[model samples]
Target: MTFVKNVPTQPQILAWLNHVKLFEGLTQDALMPIIENANYMDLKQGDMISYEGMPLSSCFLVLSGQVEVYRNTYLGEEKIFGIFSCYDLVAIAAVFMPHNRFPMTIRAKIDCSVLFLEKNSLLLVCKNNPIIMQRLLISFSAKLYELINNIDWLTSSSAEQRLGAYFLSLSSKQGSQFILPISRGQLATKLGMRYETLSRLISSWRKQKIIAIEGNKVMILNVTYLDELTLPSQRAF
Candidate 1:
C-alpha cells in the first residue's frame, strides 16, 4: 500500500468525485472543500486497508478496482462480507456511528485507488448542504438493507442456493459470461462454504450443463436451471 504524497489537483479530484453517488448533485462550490481535503492512496492486491475496530476518521470512495470486506472466523478462516468496486463508498455508516470504528477488515482484492474523505470535512459539508445529507441517508439506508438481506441469505439459504445467488448477481452485472473477480477459495469463503464443497457443486453444475467454468471464467449455460437452485420464494421474476 502506498500513500499518495503529491495531492491530486482540484479538477482531478472533482473528476473522480463526480462519479460518486453521494456527491451526485452537489455543485463545484459545495464540493470544493472536500476536494481540497481529500487524500489519495494506491493499494496493491492483498494490501490491508483497515482492520476490525480500527478508528474511523475517514471513509473511502473506490476510484478503481475492488476491495473485500471480511472477518476472521473462530477457526481462523476468513468469512467474506462483500466485495466493493468503483464508485462504491466504504465505511460511510461507520463514520456516523456512535463508536466511529470499522466493524470489519477491508483489503484490496486487486490493485486499486481510493479517495479518503475525512469525517470532519464530510460533516461540515453536509451541515451547509442538506442535499448531501439527504444523499448520505439514502446511501446509509441502502447499506442497512443490504446487510439485512445478507444475514437472511447466510442463515437461511443452502450452500448451493447461496452460490447460485452469487453467480446470478455477477451475471446481472457482467452478462452471462465473465471472469470471477476473486479466486475459487475466496469465492468459497464469500458464499460461506468449504472450498471442496464449492468445487463439487460447480463440477456438478458443469456436468448438468447448468454452467461452464474454465479456470476463473464462468459461463452460465442455463440461467433458468441456476435460478431454480436458489430459494423459490426469493427468486425474482
Candidate 2:
C-alpha cells in the first residue's frame, strides 16, 4: 500500500468527485472543501482497506480498480458481499449508522486508487449541505437493494443455478464479454459454494458451449441457455 500525500489539483479532484454517485449534483463550491482535505492512497492487491468492527476514522471512494467487501463466518470462511469499482464509495453507511464501526472487511480487490475523507470533516460538510446527506441516503438505499439480490445466490439449489444468476447479473451490468472483477475463490464465496464446486460448474457449462472462459475473462456463448437455468421457479432466495 502506498500513501500518496500529494493531493491532486482542484480541477482534477472536481472531475473525480463529480463522477461519484454521492456527490453527483454537488456544485464546485460545495465540493471544494472535500477535495482540499481528501487524502489519496494507492493500494496494492490484498491490502486491507478497512477491518470489520474497526472504528470509523474515515470513508473511502474508489477512483480506480476494485475493492472487496466481505465478512467471515464462525468456521473462518469468507463471505464476499460485493466488489466495488470506479466511482464507487465504500462505507458510506458506516459513517452515518448508529454504531460507528465498519460492518465488513474491505480489501483491495486489485491495485486501486482511493480517496480517504476523515469522518469529522465529512460530517461538517454534510451538516452545511443537506443535499450531501440526501445523496448519501440514496447510495445507502441502493446498497440495501444489492444485499437483497445476493440472497438468491445463497439459496440456489445447484451450483449451476448460482453461477447462472451471477453471470446474468454481470451481463446486465457490464456487456456480455466483460472480465470477472474478483478472483474465482472470492466468486465462489459470494455464491456460497466451494471453489471446486464453482470450477466444476464452469467446466460443465463450457462442455455444453454455454460459456467460453479464458483465464479470468468469461464470455457467455448462449445467453438464452443461461437464462433458462435461472428461471424464477428455480431460484431459492
Which candidate number maximizes lDDT? 1
lDDT of 1 at 79: 78
| 1-237: candidate 2 lDDT, tens digit per residue | 788777687888878888876677778788766777888899999999889999998888899999999998877877888788898888877888788999999999889999887787778779889988887777778767766665754574577777888888888887888688777987887777889999988898899999999998889999999888788624343
> Worst lDDT window (10 residues) for model 2?
228-237
Cα lDDT, all candidates: 0.86, 0.83
Q: Report how far residue 182 has shifted in candidate 2, in Å.
A: 2.5
Against the true structure, candidate 1 has what lDDT? Answer: 0.86
Task: RMSD for all candidates, in order, please.
Answer: 2.2, 3.1
Tens digits of per-residue lDDT for model 1, 23-126: 87677788877887899999999999999999898889998999999888887778777788999888877887898889999999989999998888888888
Q: Alpha-carbon error at 165 in model 1, in Å?
A: 1.6
